[model samples]
Target: MTTSSSSSATHGRSPAGLDVSASFATTLHTPEHIRIAEELGFKRAWLYDTPQQSPDVWMTLALAAERTHRIGLGPGVLVPALRHPMVNASGAAALERLAPGRVAVAFGTGYTGRRAMGQQPVSWAYMTRYVTAFRALLRGETVEWEGSPMRMLHTPEYPRGAPDTIPVYIAAIGPKGTAIAESLGDGVFIMGIDGVSEEVTKKFESVVYGTAGSVLGDGEDLGSERLRTAAGPALAQLFHISYELGGEEAVKALPGGLEWLAVVQETPEAERHLAVHHGHLLRLNDADTAAWNAGGNTLVGHTLTGTAGDVLARVKDLAAQGVTEITYQPAGDIRRELEAFADAVGLRR
Candidate 1:
């Protein structure tokens, strides 16, 4: 399991939950999907930001805000390097006005957003500045930037800020990012439970889960073909991130770590992002599929696929592990997956 530690020291009350949420890449579906999620009783809706392939993140979220009520909405994890803090804060502020007290934002060191552009993830120092400045500006506080003080512009006509304060969640993988969240953020967003150390649960106010899930047929293997078809690309992306963040050892920790790493390594550095693009939910090549098959599923990196009861049990198991919020993103027909998973989880329209 992925583990993260939260700091005992926090600036304010932390946000906590034991609820379900829906996540999607902009191209996976549309804003209406968020409404469907809300109808099905999901507590939150998260949108992905992949500038090269997906639709505009903020407008999509705005559409979600205008169409839905109650369910929290925000980027699943906005890459700090892609946009300036002021720009990010302005978009969030506008969305908050449309849906006050119901919007949350998460920040991350660019992965898809950066890699797609043939760049590497930004420095942790840059990520910290982006998040810290974004938070301060959202609160209408002045923060020094580029050798000058900057604050998100506020006007009576627009009120570009959250209701009281916009809740912030930082996407963390290793110790450094988690430590940053523990020290500065209101919550932590993680890809798997393995990253969540026992120490983290006690420190952060909220923990948001990110996972690839699909319904399973009877007697499916841990590395079932159906799951591979639906969520294989996502699983591939998981290993890709592991290798990118922590190198070979980290990728080895994944279900199909070594084999997949080999296939990924075979690709040219300029084309590396393609190996994990398109939400990494599907469109894998034969070699990649073979590598994935060679590596069986594991505790921390398996797709959520099973009978309704089985899926529910898995979700509960995660909740028991201090997962305050689970963001489910299926890899196939968005509506069908959402409806099925929603039903399986006992969520009703």
Candidate 2:
């Protein structure tokens, strides 16, 4: 189950769920695939977006919403700078209209594609302000600042408004971004091949979440959700964790697997990009395998490089740390990998 369906606040515990996603491929037989995903016991479906080589995240999600009923849907981390906030605001509103009560949005600072295009990163302070403002707009509130009034464009022919009650998840990486997530007092979405340390997670919440003593207004659970406080979850990463632990076969799937191995030897920054780049390369499955392995651009550090059982156990261990949502990028055929995952994690009812 996802935080949306958790229902644990009444009992003083957090709820947990999994996020199944891939950022590449515009259309993955989505109508059929998402249904398969729902049947496989996946909690929710997450989509990703980039300038080139990847499908439009929100567009794919709106399409997927028509296919699945019980599962949830949203962008894993749509970078705000990619387009006008109105684009995101409008797209989200429309998706909610179609899927009613099943839409959520996650915003992140984008790691790879945007930088590849010569775009500068959006400032955290600006993002914090923009997200705060964006949420309000999505809630049917008109926003105005410095004598300028702004409201989303609407029309009778194609009328839509932001859902009054859509959940907002923030993809906060690194210490700074994480702190912003906590201070804002909303769901914090984070996943790193190398687990983002608990101390950092705690420090992040202390600043972002602790800044204000009260849960900012009503209908928001500031204290519980900000720090992945899902109660009783023991294998949140059966999905995302698959990438890191897949080991040799996983590494062999990268764009420049050998190159990344060398880069990480000198400094770990390359490993981080390797995870992002190689994930895109393999998940899309567009690059030739022979070229990818021989080339020097593969993503290697993201690989778990361990036995399947160890990978599954690591995911379980992390869930013990309070992760509620695990977003995984599968290595082989989607259907087969999910089955292997469920068997390893015992995810059946």
Counting clashing residue pairs in each candidate, in order, gives 17, 14
Candidate 1 clash figure, as a count: 17
**10 residues in a row with least lDDT, candidate 1:** 1-10
- The whole-model lDDT of each prediction reads 0.72, 0.51
Q: Give per-residue CA lDDT, model 2, range 219-265, as digits (tens).
A: 32322221111110111122222333574355445444544344333
Top-TM-score structure, candidate number: 1
What's each prediction's TM-score?
0.82, 0.66
- Model 2 regions lying over 4 Å from their true place: 1-28, 144-148, 153-162, 200-308
The positional error of residue 213 in candidate 2, measured at the CA in angstroms, is: 40
Best by lDDT: 1
Tens digits of per-residue lDDT for model 1, 214-268: 7665676756665666666555655656666687798677666677777767778
Model 1 local distance difference test score: 0.72
